[model samples]
Structure formats: C-alpha cells, structure tokens
Target chain A: MIQFDQVTKRYSGGVEALKNLSFSIDSGEMVFLAGHSGAGKSTLLKLISGLERATSGSVMVSGHNLSKLRGSQLPFVRQHIGVVFQDHKILFDRNVFDNVMLPLDIIGFDRREAARRVRAALDKVGLLGKEKVMPIRLSGGEQQRLCIARAVVHRPAILIADEPSANLDRAYALDIMELFKSFHQVGVTVLISAHDETLMEDYGRRILRLKEGQFTA
Target chain B: MKHYLFLHWQSARTALAKILRQPVGSLLSLAMLSIAMALPLSLYLTVMSIQDWVGKLTQTPQITLFMEQSAETADIAAVSSALKTHPRVKGYTFISKKQALTDLEKRNGLNGLTEGLDGNPLPDAFVVTPASLEPKQLELLQKELSGLPMVEEAQFDASWAKRLYGMVDLGKHLTVFLALALSVALVLITHNTIRMQILARRDEIEVSKLIGATDSFIRRPFLYHALWQGLLAGLVAWGLTAWLIAVANPAIAEFAQLYNERVELRGLSPLELALVLGCAVLLATLGARLAADHHLRRVSAN
Candidate 1:
C-alpha cells in the first residue's frame, strides 16, 4: 500500500517540484500516473520509493513514513518496492540472469534460491532462453523486458515503473503493458507514469493526472 | 551479520569482475600506485640497513689517551699499572716520548731533523682497548680513565660514531615526512580515478539508486575496486623495491668493502611486507569511499 498526505517538495533553487499533492493506492491495485513533462510525476514516485524526503507533508509506503525513515532504513523499504526505468537500466557488463538477480543479491538471498528465482523471473518475462546473453546484445524491446524481469525478480509487494513505455515501439509498449497487467493479476500492486493517452485508453486502469506539480484526478 | 558480510563479499566480487573486464585500465592504475609506494618504502629499508651496520661497526675496542710532557717514568708506569688492573681494560700500550718521535719521523720523512733534537718533545700516551666497547660501558670507562692522576685527557673515537647516529635520527624524521606526502598523493590519484569511473557509470548508478539499491550496495563495488587496486599496487611496489635493492647491492657492498666492513642491504621483513599491504588496502578503501560518497550524495540529492 502507498499513501501521500498533502506532500510538498521545494527545491533550493526556488522551484516547487510537488505542491501539497495527496494520493493513496490500495494493496494489489494497478494505477497510472499521467502527466506532461515537469508535472511532478517523477517527484511523486521518488517520494513513494523513499528516495527523496518531502519538504512539508508526509508520504508513507507499506506503513513506513518516508520523511522519518533514517538513512540506514531506506534500503529495507526499497527492497520491498520494485522500480523500473524507461532506459532499461540493465548492467551492460553482466548477463541477463545476473541483471535480474541484482535485487535478490542486494537482499542477500541464498545462492541456490537466487539462481532459481532468477531463472523463473526470466522465464516469466519470456527471456529464459536468453539468460546468459549480454544485455547489449539484446533488442530494445528485449532489453526493456529484461528490465521488467529484473524489477519483478525479487517478488516485491509493489512495483513502480516511471515511463516504462517511453522509448519503445507501439507493439513493444503494448507488450510491456500486458506484462504489468499480468503482474497485477498475480496480486502485485503496480503504478506506472506515462503520457501516452492511447496506451492508457487501451489498459483502462485508474489514472491520476498531474499538471504543474498538482494532482488533478 | 553473516548476511551482511556475505552481501559485502558478493558486492566485492561483482566489482572485481567488472574491473577485470577492463584489464588495461586496471593494470595501469595498479602500476602507477605501485611505483608511488615503492620509492619511499625502499628508502626506509635502506636507512634501516645502514643503522644496523653502524651499530655493528661501533662496537669495537678502541680508546685514546693524552699525557703531559712533564710526567716522569714513575708516573707513567703507575698509570699503566693502574689501567692494567681494571676489570674492563683488555690491553694498554705505553707510547714513550722517544717512540712517538720515531713514529712521527717515519711518517713525515724527517729522520735527520729528529736526530738533531736535544730531547724527546712528545709526551707519554696510552692507547687503551676496553674489554667491552658497548656505548654506555665505554662512556663509563672513559670517565674513569679521565679521572686518573697522570692522564692528561681520555677520549673515545666517537666522532664517526656521532655522525652515524645523527644520520639515523635524520633518516627517521625524513621517512615520516615522505610517507605522509606520498600517502596523500596516492589517495588523490585513487580518488580521481574512482571519480572518473563514477562519472562514466553515472546512468547505471542513478538507476541503481532509484531502483532501491542501498548506498552500501552501490558503494561495495567501488570499495572492492579500491581494495584490488591497492593490493596490486602493493605487489608492484614490492617488486620495484626488490629490483632497486638488487641493482644497488653491489655498490653498497663496494662502499662497505672500502671501509673494511661486510654490510648487507636488508629487504622487507614479513611484518613490514604486511604493513605495506595494509597501507595499500587502507589508501584504496579511503579513496573509493571518498569518491563513492561524494558522487552518490550528488546523485541521490538530484
């Protein structure tokens, strides 16, 4: 579960990235964060992920207040929330399996168990056959899929994807959306940030719209 | 705690693998660090060897005594007899005034001038050798000898001894100063290298942090990279020092031979080698930490 109670984030340069924004999502629910560029979508996600502190109000993920969480506790909160980026974020030096295994590795998963989960996650993303392949050798669609597999590899309770379909083709983008739909069907909460109205129309999920640092849904 | 350590090791291993992917850069950094560390370490070893040699050479039985020209044979015999009875006095040679003049004439080629002199001008002297030439005991013996009735002056051949001791003191201070300067330079170089690595991998690092990688998780690989760099550099430094000693050994031996001595150059003992390794590890870890902390903070802040 994620909750934001009138959160505001002001930068030192006098720019307000988020202003008194308030929102909440129930467990196992999939939601879309719709906004134009600089509409505070990224800021909202960052606050939810405990990556940034709210300037004035409170943001809580899984009952841990983001503003009150100490530096040492941020990692524990992060291990429960899977995040994906538009750019795939795969470590180019490692193979597909290793990249997917990263989150598990960070959490100190058992070696044999980590290997099994990594294989299962790759299989889920339709990347099982390409486990040993380097990320650079994969196609753009495959790389993005690998990124998805990496995000879900740890079986996180909630998944956050910031512009997950930004750079992919229509077909690839649709495939990614379907992957998120599958994850949501399996009782995993999902939140995605996107400006593609066409894609949103196809998915038919609840959309939270933002304009000029204020949520307007 | 076991879990933390295992994760740390895994992180370090992953980092090392990544570094191995770029062998050229890693080797270059290692070589540079090794050379930087080797110079001062070699100097330190050389100073230690020289100190040991001086300690050995100064432990010889040698003393000097001056006498008055007015001293009679009876007074001279009395002084010699008294020195002979002392427990520490190993041997004493009485150099009579006539014998001193004859030795001087032989050295200066003035035999005819010495024959024309009415009487022997040189005073009686005692060349005393003590049983033990240990510094403290020798000083005590010199004091006792100087207190004798007929002896004009009692001195030790400690001029060269003083010079050797002074050099040891100077070497110690110089080693400390040089090690400090070199260590600072080493840290800076490693910091710059790590900073460059962070900048090159900026996107990866940012994404890692965004995706819930802890600072320590992100920092682990950089720390490992530093540790490896330090270890490799330490190995190279050790090799460099060994090579330098090999080349300089003959020259040092020649100098020692001229002084009628058999001095050997010493290498790093096991403890010293461990110290060198430890130093390298420390510098690399510090450098990595600085670079990682600085860049990670910047990335997380943004």
Candidate 2:
C-alpha cells in the first residue's frame, strides 16, 4: 500500500518538482501514472520508494512514514519495492545471470537457490538461454527485459517502473506492458509511469494522470 | 545464517576476481606497497642486527685510576681509600707497580724486556667497576674519580662504545619515524586505489544500491580487495627482506672475521614478521573502509 497525503517536494534553488500532491493506492492494484515529460511522475515514484522524502506533508509506504525514515532504515523499506528506471540501469561488466541475481543476492538468498530464482526470472523475461551472455550484447528490448527480471526477481510486494518502455517499438512496448499485467495478475501491486496514454489504455487499468506537478485526474 | 556466509564468500571470491582481472595494476600496486613497507622494515632489521652484534660483546664499563708515579705508598693508600668509599664504584682491585711488572713478564715474549728495565715503569692502578653500564653514568663516575688527589689519570675505554650507543639511539629514532610515515603513505595509497575502483564501478554501485543492497554489502568486496592487496604486499616485503639478509650475510661474516668475532645476519623474528603483516592488513582495511563509506554515501545521496 502507498499513500501521499498532500505531499510537496521542492528541490534546491526554488524548483518545485511536486506541489501538494495527494494520492493513495490499495494493495493488489495496477495503476498507470500518465504524465508528460516534466509531470513529476518520476519524483512521485521516488518518494514512494523512499529515495526522496516529502518536504512538508507525509508520504507513507505500508505503515512506515517516509518523512520520518532515517537513512539506515531506507534499505529495509526498499527491499520490498521493485523499481525499474527509464535508463535501464544494467551492469555491463558482469554477465546477464549476475545482473538478474542482484536483488536475490542483496536479500541474501542461498547461492543455489538464488541461481534457480535468477533462471526462473530470466526465463519469464524470455532470456533464459542468454544467462551467460553479457548485458552489453543484448538488444534494447532484451536489456529492458533484463531490468524487469532484476526488479521482480525478489518478488517485491509493489513494482514501480519509470517509463520502462521509453525507447522501444510498439511491439516490444506491448510485450513489456503484458509482462507487468502478468505480474499484477499474480496479486502484486504495480505502478508504472509513462507518457503514452494509448498503450496504458490498452491494458484497461486505473489511470492516474498528472500535469505540471499536479494530478489532473 | 548460511546465506550470510555465502554472501561473504561470494564477496571474497569477487574480490579475488577483480584483482586478477587487472593483473598489471594489481602487481604494480603490490610493488609500490611492498617497497614502502620494506624501507622501514629493512631499517628496523639493520638496527636490530646492530643491537644483536653489540649485545654479544663485553659491555661491563670499567674506569682505571692511575696513581702518580712519584707518589709513595701513602699516596696509593689515599687513592685506594677514596675509591673504596665512592658510591659510584661497585668494586675496585689495586695492581701495585711490582704486580704490574710481574704480569708484564708473564706476557708472550716480554719477560727479558721488562727484566732489563731499570725500574718498573707501570704505575700502581685501580681497575674500578662502575655500578652502571650507561656511558653517561660511567663518564660521571670517571670525572668524579679523576679529581681525586694523587691520581695521575682516570680512564675509561668507552669512546667506541659511546659512538656505538649514539648510533643505535639515532637508528631507533629514525626507524620509528620512517615506519610511521610509510604506514601513513601505505594507507593513502590503498585509499586512492579503492577510491578509483569505486569510481570505475560507479554505475554498478548505484544499481546495487537501488536494488536494496546495504552499504555494508556494497563495501564488502572493496574491503576484501584491499585485504588481499595488503597481504600480497606483506609477502613480497618479507621475501625481499630475506633476500637482502642473504646477500649481506657473507659480507658481514667476512667483516666479522677481521675482529675474530662471528656475526650472523639474521632477519626478522616470527613475532616481528607477524606484526608487519598484521599492520599492513589493518592499514589497508581501514583505508578501504573509509573510502567506501565516503563514496557510497555520496552515491546514495542521489
């Protein structure tokens, strides 16, 4: 569960990224965050993941208040939330298996069991045979899928992706959406931020629209 | 618990891999650190060896009180009584001129040479043993005895001993200062090395942090890498020091032959070697820990 009660986040130098925004999402719900380039979607998601704190109002994830959470407690808050960035933050130095196994490794899964889960996550993303392959060798869509596999590898309760399908073609974008749908169908709460309304409309989920740091709907 | 162990083991394994991945860089770092370590260590070895050599020689400092050749038996008695009551003199043995002449005749071939002499040229003397072996203390005792009436001269053959003691003192101070400076330099070297590794892996570390990795988890591999580097450097320094001692041993033995003294060039003891290696590892670990904590906090702030 996520809640933002009239939260306002202002950057240094008088830049208000999000102003007095209030929203809440229940458990087991898939919500689409529809917004333009500077609509504060990424900022909202960051606040929910405890990466950034609210300036004035309270932001709560589960029962813990994000504003009151100290730096030491952030990791525990983050372990249960999976986040995919727009830039596809994949490690090119290591092979695909190690990349996907990162979250499980963070959570300290056994080596054999972590390898098993990594394979399953990779298989789900349709990159099963490319386990030993380096991330640099993967195509754009494969790399984004690799990011997705990493996010969901630990079975986080809430999955948040920030424009995950940003540079993909229509087909790959649809496949990425379908992957989110599959995870949601398994009762995992999912929130995705995207500019493409049509693609999100195809999934027929609840859409939360934002325009210029304020919720439009 | 099992998972925790596995994570540590995995970090250690990755640390080895990272070091092996860049063999030239790792080897160069090891060489620099070993030389840094060996400079101070070699100095320490030299000081200890000198100490060992000096320790083998007779160091009981004695002061000789020579009586005036014109003095009679009363003068000898005066000087002898003064030496007996002196607090600094632990004991004194008097050698009369007749006894000195007799001892001279007992030498290798000086029997007839001393017999033909008109009178005994040797003065009556007292070989006075001081209570302390310290050069300054013995000098004070000699000075005190030299001012005695009817005393021709008060002598202590400790000039070479004084010089040796001074050199040993200087060596000790130099060794400590050099060790401290090199230890600090080694810490900085390790810190910079780990800082560069962190910079190179900035993306990797950022991603790891985003994926819920704790700071300790992220720092584990870098710490292990520093540890391995320090351990390798220690080993190299030990080997180099041993080789140096080996090369100098024969020369030292030959030099000692001139003095009819057998000197052995021994390297560091087991305890000292352990101390050197332990210091290396501890310094490296401290540097890596500091660097990792600093850089990771900056990365996570974003």
The CAPRI quality class of candidate 2 comes to medium
Off by over 4 Å in 2: B1-6, B55-58, B65-151
Interface RMSD of each: 2.4, 1.5
- Taking the true A–B contacts (Cα pairs closer than 8 Å), what share appears in each candidate? 0.41, 0.61
Q: How does each model score on lDDT?
A: 0.86, 0.89
At residue A107, what lDDT does model 2 achieve?
A: 86
lDDT of 2 by residue, B143-232 (tens): 889998889999886667667877988999999999999999989999999999999999988988887788888899999999989988
Question: How well does candidate 1 match the true structure, expressed as C-alpha RMSD?
Answer: 4.4
lDDT of 2 by residue, A71-154 (tens): 878988899999888888899999999999888888888778889899999999999999999998999999999999999999
- Per-residue lDDT tens digits for candidate 1, residues B1-302, read 99888888887787789778999988888778888899789889988998888877676647777787778888888898899899989998888877888898887778787668887777788989899867788889999998888788987877577798899989988988888888988898789888998888777777677666778888888888888888878988998899999999998899878767888778899999999999988998998899988887887624
Off by over 4 Å in 1: A10-19, A35-39, A91-95, A132-137, A167-171, A201-205, A211-217, B15-23, B66-75, B84-125, B129-153
The residue pairs that clash in candidate 2, if any, are none
